[model samples]
Target chain A: MVSIRDVAKAAGVSTATVARVLNGGTPVSPDRTERVLRAVQELDYVSNGVAASLSRGRTGLLGLLVSDIANPFTAQVARGLEDEAVRHGYQVLIASSDFDSEREAQVLASFARRTVDAVALLSSSGVGEGVARLIRNGIPTVFVDRRPPDLGEIPLVRTDSLSAAREAVRYLIDLGHTDLGMISGPAGMPTAAQRLAGFREACATAGLVVRPKCVREGFLGTQGGYTAMCEVLDLPVRPTAVFSFNNVLAIGALEAVRERDVRIPADLSLVTFDDTDLFPFVDPPITAIEQPAYDIGAEAGKLLFARIDGAETAGTDVVLPTRFHVRGSCDRPGR
Target chain B: MVSIRDVAKAAGVSTATVARVLNGGTPVSPDRTERVLRAVQELDYVSNGVAASLSRGRTGLLGLLVSDIANPFTAQVARGLEDEAVRHGYQVLIASSDFDSEREAQVLASFARRTVDAVALLSSSGVGEGVARLIRNGIPTVFVDRRPPDLGEIPLVRTDSLSAAREAVRYLIDLGHTDLGMISGPAGMPTAAQRLAGFREACATAGLVVRPKCVREGFLGTQGGYTAMCEVLDLPVRPTAVFSFNNVLAIGALEAVRERDVRIPADLSLVTFDDTDLFPFVDPPITAIEQPAYDIGAEAGKLLFARIDGAETAGTDVVLPTRFHVRGSCDRPGR
Candidate 1:
């Protein structure tokens, strides 16, 4: 329990000078600063973060909530946010919601209780009540990759999923694939809903009927994709091309295809969303809609910090464009 | 700013009852608990974590340091730790060391300043001084994946990388491949040292010559792997088979091989360490030594919690076994 007084005594400096040096406040002479640091180190005097936070009314902590930390896309976003937070001299407290709205709400409540300086959400479930709670607590928040409806003005950084999905589907249609299939994410998630809408728009524009049997809802996991892909394969009139709206789902669908000995592109052209590093190593690689996951996170982090610093950043919606990477996964339909 | 008194009055309960409910202390009646929760929600009451932590001397926060969070193996470990922490009513604050000892030290100091209940380290760099600081501060710690020597029995939960590497190399030898190349991590890292030792032991047992020109060092990254593999390939007498002691390095080596139009398992056999989800999808589906990353994390988390709960777990070293998954990445070296 060594205190600032002990550090000051060891350094032969005043308590005020020690506080200034430790808190990164007004600068002290270089020689004094060196002495203070060395003495603090030798005495092992750790400033009580709790006490400092209580007095300053700031925790120097940022809260980040993600649906799944194990997901590569989510992990990249977290990495970006963490890097940015470190640059701003803040540490991030991360909690996973596991795609459950209740869990998300509980985590948000915990963040509120912790009095985190700001919060960022990549929630896959409904965040209406949880966000309202944050706002009620006067906590600055930013949305990443998911947007809540009617939330007045919370800054958000997200990918243009609709346009990306539309372009991917149109590519398949251009390759003379009149019948198309899709493995969509959970219906309620905003990203999923947008991708699904994009799929419909692409089919309608091409004068192609999107068979209900060909469209299956996936749980944004590999198993969900496997099940949905199997159902699509079992259809009476199978689709010539299929789109899996997420990388994990695409992986599962690929497994399903490989298990059934269905050759990619040759037998059924495939397209996927959210290109990750592993895409290139996969057999035949994958043609994917690449979302700027890192950028989205970095932007959200910047926006949250701006709000925390008392900037009027309400209603700032930053939508980054996606890239269409044409790889070895898709080709024209064959006999 | 909503005080306990206000919530107690609104719920028609005593302030003690409100505090008990909010702090998850002695349980009150279910009816009263329900009323207190409703009143809390209606009034948007948030307990001050900093003030409560100051009084209680526990922050309910666990600190985790990893080399890289974006790596899938690291992410899985983090996910396991987070899940275990959540089950025990604690949250995790994760920081990446990025393989720099200075950064690792800084993060540990911050964790101490914040008074985290416990810490888990997956540090790639020398953590001697950082760990000493933690010990001096009386903070419970568990080592995951990497262990620092002469630490006087700090609990460590890690994979048996040495034996796993030996087995993987043995499999390559049994396939009649004598000349073998390796892409090893930085020399000082414990995991890399152990893996390199295992490779040598296997080669020695097989009466194979260990060529200095064939063994290249990598930085635990894809680019590092690529550079090392290129050097190996440029050798006057290239080895028939190669072992990458890490997954990212193997990815880089694979890329280099692909660029040269050299077919895997035909022109050159390959084996890798750390089997992740993406391994199965990779071209040729790499044969790998699968470390139980998630289990290591979960076990370390359990050990850390036990230490935090005042259990006598000093010097407990838990070494989880690794599994060798034989995939399509390896075969007898052929003309």
Candidate 2:
């Protein structure tokens, strides 16, 4: 094990100077702080807080890891978790991965070191390594929103994005539209893959064939959605209806369409996943699949508390239902 | 400090067994885990992660505290900070305070214990005790958006909300409006107080008296804004124009007016602080005072990195400028 003395020697500083830097904020010279940091990295010193905290037990804190805390979807779910935790006296520490796997691993390791009671994760790039550590450490963990396709034997509480997306496509087909364009999420993410799969399955069941050009994958961001929409629009014999995977994507797609002088649901009906306040207020009032982010958080909290209470439990996969918010944005083709 | 041995003795476990539990996941029995947790709580043991981390140096991490990460205003700023820090290879750990001062204190303490590089705060309920502790401990701390009105010697980077709000009100007044109503945020928050003061100052300068009934204080939440808007609407001789303090409030207030079947700008001119995508997409795109949330975060990150690089600096109050986004929502009021 790397010790304070070793780090001190490597950094060419006194053990106390190293401690001052490590303890955070005691006005150590920047040069000494830099040297100590380098030494710690070289030594690969594991944090002792988790070990120390385990002696104290259940920090009454739950660590939440997601790609972007600023993402409205993530934020809403967090709000639900934060509000519910108050009932059982748990505070949440949320960190953003910014879609980087390495960052996620570092944060997960930090959470474990903090000895949080549990973890609620919305996996960015398959939090595989971090999940492995959490499980090995016996810290209860639950996946939220997006997780790996399968966790072998781990608890997950998330919206059924695939089923909801399928239902959305079916609704559009029933409204008498065959030619449909889809704005898909990035390929690697399970949410994106599932939604695309559902869209294909729905088209297959309806005996309708979608042109390859009509299905475009994007970074699942605003600009990605807009560019994809433009591509779909330029396609010869463009689809009369479009299915955007989520709210942000829908917003961008809608903007692209708005720039063109097209009447919504008359020229092109639009539907997307993820409902938010802005959806209903948009000029045409977009129809969307509500992910029920709050409910997912509430359920994740429930599962976590059960584990913290030492419940002899199975690794349950709690799949919550989604609802389609019908609005003026979708209608019979050429309405 | 309460040692692991003490915890083990209290839990009727051996020192090695206690070590196994603290080190995490080597699999102690559920009964033993329960007993250990109880013992730890009774002993009030804090983990030694900070000591371990300090022995190492610069965690390559920064801590950010905000009232609500879900709040669009807060989230956008976080996005900027997160985006900027990646340039310097620093990751951010953002904790939602949920607008509670107590939670802010606890999170701050944990950050210090974990030995993060520095902290950026978007205060809720004035980061009183926590700021004191951070300063006393020599942690480089900077304030973003909202801080205590008087911190004497702390760096603060925020949008100039007061001047912006005042300018917005003056614009409305100049647009042929004698009477006006306002949906103000809770008075306790410095942001709220500043905006309110700006409005009052503007009214005084215009030689206009604010009717007490036209002013309402909301929780700065959707429902609160809705209720306040309704009250203002029902007042006898209602003001022709309304100024909402921020985006969320504007959303709720807009819904209230939408239900009333009144023509915007003509029946009731509306202006607000905080421009969002929804504002421009709505019917009669909103007139808004755009607070530069991202710029504020970017500047905060810059100030923090400077402090981390060992710049001997005095407390800086960096106030960024706001822009008025004029849209069709405001017109010469009539009918």
Candidate 3:
């Protein structure tokens, strides 16, 4: 029920000053800006300002395709993309592929038919063919999260999965976990390949012998993690520590450990590749590498917009850094 | 990389049959449909069909405005909506309102400017004015999750927050928790109002004291929940239990409880209004009312499409059921 007038009155500012703060293109004084913002938040006043006139023939629509929306990581990336796209006067039409490569291709084709101004793909697995088609058609596309192996000149916005993975592995090794195990995605996917590379490099560098049984193939899915974890648990020599390469895997691995009566950081240590709010709330708060999904999304949107604006330089790969959030899950590995 | 020909060959169907199965124009027999689907899944084939030549003059875009995308519940709803929309040969342009009514209005206006065919307004706190404007503008709008009070005959697709909330509160009281508190969203918001109504009605029916101190105002935000939980913990007679009516609030409430060393289900029983996959992994996995968000989304998409297809009828309010998922968090009240 609160209006701009009410906000203006509350802040002792004019309606124009309030408008200037709410919408860009006009500027207000520092004190006025602060007062207007505070008044807006206090009054919960939403401006009915229409977006600046969109460029003609530009539908002002961008296409975003992800493997899954239910995944917290993917959803966060999507939030970042949607927020940034809206800021640039573009609305995003998001499609989920459910990790199905074919569905991914179909979604892209649908986007093409809709004639979106540009596209942002989040770390595709089986959809490289669809992406190739997009590139062949000359549509502005930005790869996010994971890039295709042969995407020679495509701009990519991804987190440093390799270094983060390596550091996490190294951290576990430092904690005296010589016999460590990893639950990883299918070996063929680019993100999976990079993560696996990190795991191998870290183990090899630390003079730790990573037997073939210690590395289990997973689909980056909960069930995949459960099955893989069970395999590791049934091995003759139980791993002193486990590093799940993604969120769902971590969840499944934890469930397996719980089922087996294995205590985290006591009987075994744990490290997960991705982090979520849930991690902090869980028992033995999980140690994880926080993938900055939002930043990747924001950066992808910026790159896509730049291409739409006719940025003609070769593709720029924006590799955002990852951070390690250590909690009670990882500790010294007892004999 | 799998082509229609390959799928047809693998499934022992003609190319036309494969096309008919993937695209909805012509219905294929059950046997052929099964074969085609299996072939598609096995081969990882994605049909690049351009959505069955959508009706000319139809923009083939539906606008979905939600309060938050980062929220798991919202994200799941979005996934369901996107999947259903895709099946119907439409794509969704999603915008997050961040529970701000003003931003909701602006996003609707932008959707209008872009000529999206119809819209699905997800549960939100502050955008009735914008929604009303859309209704007046005669753009097909289906209110999702939260419907505006006094809005004449606006179709709504929502989970039953009222009955479910009442039952949850009553369930706790049945276990002998005479004292109770609730973390509720801001007043005057439709969803918040409904939930609060349920809480009050339940307490009154049970002859429990409905003191103002038992109710804490929150924004359905993490900070809101944190502040409200702090207040509730400081209450002279802290309630035997607390029900956080939303996800973030529940998280904040749990954190506060943990900080205070309040043993869940022993010192204080806890119940949250929504469920996420993360709940189970946490210690004393949260007991929650699981809102079937995917069904709501899928149904909303169907309704919007029906409206778009010119189904003239009175507004339909489809209220889905909510199921209680009790974990280790809720039990008999103890000293």
Candidate 4:
């Protein structure tokens, strides 16, 4: 291991000079700085984070909590967060709660114990209680993807799910489809509730009857969508078009329609919320409400740093817009 | 926040007894344990990891290095690793390198500074040069997915890429396809090289000639696969069947064929390496070589713990098998 003393001795300078160069404390002469850097490279010196943290009383780490890592949407959000965090000279410690409230609480406590400079969450469950408790105890927190119930002024980064849902529903309505159904996400999730509300609002504005039989709440994955679609398909008067609240549900609906030999845009029209890089490859290319997931993550990261830098004011909410991607899956009935 | 003294007073036990109950150090009367547990629940006591580390002289945190977090394959591997790690009373610190060697080295140095108990890597770019320094300094490490060039004896958990590729190619061959092309992964990646070797060996065994125009190398992602497929499509003598080295490439090939109006199976047969949860949902349903990614991660985790426990032996390599899933994409040349 190359110590500051070794670098100082190699460069014929004092150890304080080497320390100053490494820590960027005070400027050193260009010649001495070059010598110190050369010695560092040659010796392959790696700083000890534990020792540094002990001296500085900070870990230079940020903690992130997500509902699940297996979900591609959440994974993409994490990717954006990590990119921005690393750029800002911070590392991330990630924890997944699997949408379990107890697990979310445990992860929150763990993050606090690690003394991370700040925390971010993509919480669907009401783990905001734990987060609020942490805030009361003076830990900086920023919520992403899901807005907590009592988020009054707390910094939140999210997509405009309600408006996105309305846009998707309106697109289907424009396609000359009156009989519509929806497969929604889990009931308690704020985003899911907002999307459902948007769907109803769109139906009322268009003078289309919103039937109770058309909606089902469950997991936001393929199986959930499949089961929900089955229910809708079994109705005495089945919907001619379906708006899936998320991509997983849309995928499930596609599979369901295919299994039943229902021709897309001929017998049924479909549109999904959220788009991924892989979505374009699907046959009949899905019409989607594309959320700016990457931008949301970057914005949340910047906000978190702001809070960490003593922006003691109550955090603000940032809702990014979603774009409607018109593709082959959405078209006029009997196309 | 509840203290041990509070729990002790409520349970009518000494503080030492309360501590032992919380740490699960010794057996206590069931009645007393229940009382203490109730008190803990009522008071909402959360254990602090840093404070515990200070008392125990270890943080109980492990570091994980992944090539990319956005890659679904890597994400699945990480999920498996973390699942096993958490079960054994450890949390993971994740860092991604984006396939850059310098970033990988930086993450390695960062993990070491944190004094992580062990480190696991999903796809390491460079050989054990930088990590060898960590090993010399007494840090335990286990490589997953990819291994260093010189660290032959180091602990490694990887899928049998040779067999996986052979099976994927043989599946296409068995489907009555003769002219086949392959989209390979980036150069210098051990898994990619091994997969290519397997493909070549399978062709040689069947007395099939591999055309020079049939192979191209780049990162394993949607764009990489797409670019390679564009190159393959531009060739004067295009293959009747194609085998993509990984799922990302398979996705790219799917898109390319769609763009070119090339009908799958009827016009081109396709098979891919590494099946993910999302693979089956793609249109035409891709056939794939399914590597036991989760098992590999679990095995690597166990290996790391074994080393940490002072197994007193040289590191070992464990290679798991791959299964080929036949789907709708491959067929007889005439379809």
TM-score of the first chain alone, every candidate: 0.93, 0.81, 0.82, 0.87
**Candidate 1 residue runs with Cα over 4 Å from true position:** A5-17, A24-42, B5-17, B24-42
Q: Which regions of candidate 4 deviate over 4 angstroms?
A: A1-47, B1-48, B51-55
Query: What's the TM-score of each model vs. the native?
Result: 0.95, 0.80, 0.83, 0.88
- Which one wins by DockQ: 3 or 4? 4
Q: Find the 10 residues in a row with the least total lDDT in model 2 chain B.
A: B46-55
Judged by TM-score, which candidate is best?
1
Interface RMSD of each: 1.4, 7.1, 8.1, 3.2
* DockQ for every prediction shown: 0.73, 0.18, 0.25, 0.44
Clashing pairs in 4: none
lDDT values, one for every candidate: 0.87, 0.80, 0.80, 0.78
Output the better candidate (2/4) by DockQ. Answer: 4
Candidate 2 structure, TM-score to reference: 0.80
Q: Quick one: best lDDT, which candidate?
A: 1
The root-mean-square deviation over C-alpha atoms between each candidate and the true structure, in angstroms, is: 2.5, 11.8, 10.2, 4.4
Query: Judged by TM-score relative to the true structure, which candidate is superior, 1 or 2?
Result: 1
**Per-residue lDDT of B1-335 in model 1, one digit per residue for the tens?**
78778899999999989989987859789999999999998987888788788878888889999988888888888888988998898888888887777888889888777558899988888777778888788888888888866774888888888888989999999999999999999988888999999999999999999899999998877899999999998887889899998998988898889887878888899999988777887888889888788888888889988988889888888988888999998999784
**lDDT tens string, model 2, A236-291?**
77799999988888878877887876678789999998988877777788898988
DockQ winner: 1
Question: Model 1, B63: alpha-carbon shift in Å?
Answer: 0.6
User: What order do candidates take by DockQ, descending?
Assistant: 1, 4, 3, 2
lDDT of 1 by residue, A1-335 (tens): 89888999999999999999977869899999999999987887888888888888888888999988888888888878887888898878888888877778888988887558899988887777778878888889888997777774888899888888998999999989999999999998888999999999999999999999999998877898999999998887889899998999998898889888888889999999888776887887899999888888888889988888899888888989899999988889986
